[model samples]
Target: MVSYEGINNARPKTWATAADEWHALAKYSLDAAKDLREYGAKPLKDNWTDEVGATAAAEFAKLADQLEAAYDILLSVNMVADGMTTTIETAHSTMRAAVDLATQYGLEIGVDGTVTGPPPRSRTEAEEMGPYRAQVQDLVDQAVEQVTAADRLAAAEFAELAGQTGLTDPGKALNDLQTHASHVQMQMLANDIPVDEDPTTVRQWWNGLTDRQRKDMMLAQPVALANLDGIPADVRRELRGNGKYDRVKVVEYALANWDKGDPTDFGNNCTNFVSNALLHAGMKEKTSIWGTSDDDSWMIGNRTGVDGVDKRLAYSDSWAAAENNQNFMLEHGGSEVPRSDVKPGDII
Candidate 1:
């Protein structure tokens, strides 16, 4: 749990800086060990066949490999440090803002993250402080959630990154070391996300993350995240890589443009908003085929009016109505999933 006083006094950047220094030193040592292998060990093993020279070269190679394993451990430590720094900074700032808001609204917050109503002279004043106190409590809770999640994730990551095990193959000794860095990055993303499936909550979680944190999650589990709603279009694009219709982009665009339609949609309607997002994400549009019933096709037709500044828009029911759009997508290779299987980008 995060407290007001803890948030005020915590220095996450200091921890991150210390970790970086240690990483730099470890990298330097790793480079030196590599140098030993190349210049000291390899040359001796290649040219000196005598028993003493060969034994010394073998020892140099073994010591260099051990140094590499240590370096790998330090590399994982630096990764965790950076992740913790971002998490702590975000939580601290969130808690501080809550406190500031409480002060602005005539509420009092204690060091233990308890929000209290202001001393009101009248019943009306007391009633007015209720919302302010609630807001402060929300922020405090958010900070605690963020920090507690980080604490749990960091513990697991440290254990995995620094675990010692028996090594049977000398050649495979560096394999675990080589893979730890990327695995540690994925571990950094194993945080507590909201289970309520609120789009706003999910988006807030995504936005609060640092770039490295975002990228690591993106690279580690792009497909799963691509299905997550509330992620931005560009990140989803990077996740998909291919030029297919991105479900993440579709959801993002629909939510952002629901009330007011963009030029691409040309209709200030809910179905139009969703269709625009689908088209923008590379879903092909269908034209009128049979008679021009709104349900006969799924397409947006735009035209210029006599007054050039004024434009007119045409749409089929499938493109402008919710029920029709649902039917259209269902007929076009989309299957409905159970609530437990719902992803961020699901149409529902």
Candidate 2:
């Protein structure tokens, strides 16, 4: 068992407090300059004509400018620190939740972030734990990914800021950020379930999934479609759901509601719009590979959820995001075609 209590809190809230103090110091510097000009320099200028007084007043003005610049930098620092803290904390929360779920299912996470379990002595026990083990493993993997993503995002943002402010060698900082970004990109590329794998191999794996496991995972992890290979092309074509589809209607509905989905309300809903278009084109919603709930296999709800407010049209990120949409299309009898070959109603 791992004690997830204090892996990292992004240096606690102490940094934020320190930032407040720096802000106050900046203000004090500005106020002091103001007082020197008002009660000291201005009075000297009014009463006595001297180069020394003029120089002192000019210096006070310079001091005030420096103070304001310092304030701006300190504020930027505070914002960056706060943002990174929030990101790391969110990662910690997600990691903790994953660990808890794994533990609940009798799984243990090794220090390396791999998942293990209580040794199963019997065939029945092994069989029963199979699906659960996969789920726990998935959760652990996700937790690791969340942490990595948080680190990369923070690092990249910091590098950008540093480069902009010339605080560090911009080239070096940007190179480091690029390395981190590339690593993430490569990880994702390596994990992608190649669509070109043999249909037979894909089918065997798909067939091995228990019916309930299939439904649960499809709803819970649509990304699996993008990462797991070995389902017959025809099966993937059905989108794990049974339905008739009219690509023309899909296109028509999309054109009709071109600006309807609120981009501000949800993350870009292009995929969600495509999914709805398929539905409008007459693809039936199936629980196994289709649904409208936040965690359903595939769906964007008809309306946004707002308390005491009239319902507004809404959609799910999975249904609307490109990657998931591409997975859905590939699994459900769609394939990539050449740009020149595409017809007006065809989905890209």
Q: Each model's TM-score? A: 0.55, 0.39
Ten residues in a row with the worst lDDT in model 2? 307-316
Predicted candidate 2 versus true structure: per-residue lDDT over 1-348, tens digit per residue: 222333343453664576467557646755765776687667767766688877776666555454444444444444445444443343354455556667788787776666788899999999998876766555445434544554555466556545544222323323454344334433332222223444442343344444643443343334345244664555344343343674445555765787785433344455656666777778765443333443435554445355212122244434667776677667766678897555434666
lDDT of 1 by residue, 72-95 (tens): 666667767776776677666556
Error of 1 at 200 (Å): 7.2
Clashes of 2: 11
Q: How does residue 288 of candidate 2 score in lDDT? A: 37
Residue pairs clashing, model 1: 229-344, 294-317
